[model samples]
Target: MTQPIAQPAQSTVPASKVLDRVLVLEMVRVTEAAAIGAAKLIGRGDEKAADAAAVEAMRAALNELYMDGTVVIGEGERDEAPMLFIGEKVGLAPGKGPKIDIALDPLEGTTITAKAGPNALAVLAVAEEGGLLNAPDVYMDKIAVGPGYPDGIIDLDRTVTENVTALAQAKGVAPSDIVACVLDRTRHDDIITELRGLGCGIVLISDGDVAGVIATTNEDTGIDIYVGQGGAPEGVLAAAALRCVGGQFKGRLVFRNDDERARAKKWGITDLNKQYDLTELAKGDCIFAATGVTDGSLLAGVKRKKSGVMTTESVVMRASSGTVRWVRGEHRAKV
Candidate 1:
């Protein structure tokens, strides 16, 4: 069984005035606890067990927030998954003060957790009501550049080489100075070939596009650009992070199967190729939180012991004030 993290003594923030927003942050902390709980079960080699634990804990945590929140972009649409499904209601039972929009991925990397691979997390982002775009579960082609690259340096429609050359030119550096991250799959062969031909270094991820996209925004990661097809949900979450860090990202939905197209239709999405700027996906003022389930560039995986557990998280930015906080939390197990 899993246990909740020990809550700090009541915050100095007044409950009547600031508690609503503070409750949202606390909700995110609970989700982190849920993810760490599930991660402990990863090494035991049961995928279902891990996902089930995470989903349940995350749902319970969301339910505890004091405001009325709706899942704008969530696990799946109605008839898809139960907890945190799109359109699901969250927060206090009834008559809550403010309404908010929530975007969450209870288990960002189910496979990574199951295989005990690197870079998995419990991720969530919140914004004002109707702030987040309703993203269907589909592939999104994305291109991102770090802060130093002047705006308009990379174009998603441009050829890979063209974009790389443009980035190099914008930075007044040679192509070799750029490091691009892409998914490590055979489908990315052409992208890899083009980058290599341009004298750019490549860092490939086996899974987890969130890490790949976020990597480009951080200086220490050595990733200048992230380009490839990845989960649409992750794209929104990444956009929220990039918003605070002053990076640029553009994404377009890619439908691989009839079912995916059908899903898109339900969302009133007529153009599958329409490009979405980061702001379009994650609208005004978003707070993003993520706790690593396994070790990766941005955060350390949860560590557990008989008496207590320790978890690390990287909170890219808070929509309210655009502050970035990276927190390490330690929880002592109850006797």
Candidate 2:
């Protein structure tokens, strides 16, 4: 059984100090809850069921954070999702602590979780109001690399070959030596073809850009760069993670339809294709929490036991001190 961690009382400290404590505990709590929800849907083969469980669990956990946290980018629109919708207020009402903005992916890979595949996770990021971008639910073209590369090494306007060559040159390696991670979707055919032409190795994922972006920061994963179009919400979460690890990421919004374009208008985004730097997605110091729903490079799947279940999470960086923490929790099943 997985058990909830005991939370300390809300502090009357400064906003910075309060954020530090909230980031650590809130992330751990929500991640564990999301893992439990994922575990409950295991073997069900219902993606919506798995996502619903994770969303509900994560929503409840956020309510306990004791801050005036708002869901800047979340599950869906105000009328679309019952919980964690855009502009929804979370955390304690008033007189608590700092007012923050939150962006989350309760179940980053709904299909992956239902299929019990790789790279599925429950991810969330928090920053001060106006710190996190309230991106609409739309596709985003992304290019990312780990720390040490010069700024502007990759941009959305650049061709895949040009970006790959630049990254390879920056790393002092042949183009063939670079490995890029991309979504295994037909839309990425041109990018994939270009990468192949450049002799760069490619790693394909079915879902979960959070894992793809984080993979770039870890040498063992062999994912030198991540280039593809994925959810804008996941892009912000990835930016939060990369911020902690000293990585560089850039994204550009891509709206596929009028509905999506209209949604962008709600956020004051006129140029739907404008590039967004990592800092533009998530600014200042922030905390990012993620727990694997099915298994991934950064964390493991939820472990179910007779009485309860255990879930593991990796926090890329602390908003307060820039420290990373890996947390595991257990919860008992209700009788």
Candidate 3:
């Protein structure tokens, strides 16, 4: 059985207002709730159950907030998803807050969670109205690098070898000393082969390119660059993260069928082959938050104790302030 959401809030404040810091912490709570919900289904071998639980939990938490939010990027369109679909309103119906555009993946790696694999996350991003790109659900070719590099360090149009070579030179390292993260998919065979032939280190992930992309920002991950094709919505989310922290990301949407092209058009994206940079994908003051569902590089997974206390790890970032906050939360059992 599903519970009905309360009437959502209307936008009364101007859209130009920057997102408040309080809202940033609230966003962490949202991802944390989603992570806890999906954690219960880990290793259950039921991907759908895990995803549905996350979506339900995330939506419920979102509706409790104080803002008027529209889901610009979400699970799917109205018919494709029962909840958290595109354009669905969230937050308290009578509250006074600024209008926000939200992009979220309640469970970024459903299969990974089902198999108890790694790098699964509950992720979300919020921005002022028209701040985040209304990216449609489709595949996108993406390349990214961490901070401390010159502008235009990576490009989707360049060959993998050329991009890696340029990045390595910028870092004053040999091409063989560079490390790259990529999704393990047959479509990326050429990318892997080229990296290997160039003698560069490679880290192949089964799923969750968002984590793979974020790995580029942290040197501790030993990931110097991220290159591959993944979901366009995810690319936008990653761009938001880089926008908050510091990095360079470029993405170009890839359409396989006429339906996908039409979906792009429906989203008001007319430039089918245009490559988007970091700011273009996610501009204006924004906030990005992610909680680990399964232990991975970005953050640790949810942990439950016999005393009924649960622990979660999350990272929340604000673009306006360039503040990256790492939060550790404990949920004590209710008496």
Best by TM-score: 3
Per-residue lDDT of 36-122 in model 2, one digit per residue for the tens? 787678667999889899989988888887788889889989899988899999886654667888998898888888888877888
Q: How close is candidate 2 to the true structure, as a TM-score?
A: 0.91
TM-score comparison, 1 vs 2, better candidate: 2
* TM-score leaderboard ranking: 3, 2, 1
- Where in model 1 is the C-alpha error above 4 Å? 1-24, 93-95, 314-316
Candidate 1 lDDT, 1-335, residue by residue in tens: 11121111232212223224575457557668677667777767777778778888887887776777788778787787867788888888545556777788877877789889888888887777767778888889999886656667777889888888898888788988899999998888989988888888899888888778888866677788899988898898888766655678999999999999988888778888898887788766667778888887777778776666655554545544545666667766666
lDDT, each prediction = 0.76, 0.80, 0.89
Model 2 lDDT, residue 179, Cα: 96
> Lowest-lDDT window of 10 residues in candidate 3?
1-10
Off by over 4 Å in 3: 1-16, 94-96
lDDT of 3 by residue, 105-156 (tens): 9999999999999999999999988999999999999999888898988888
Give the Cα error of residue 73 in candidate 3, in Å: 0.8
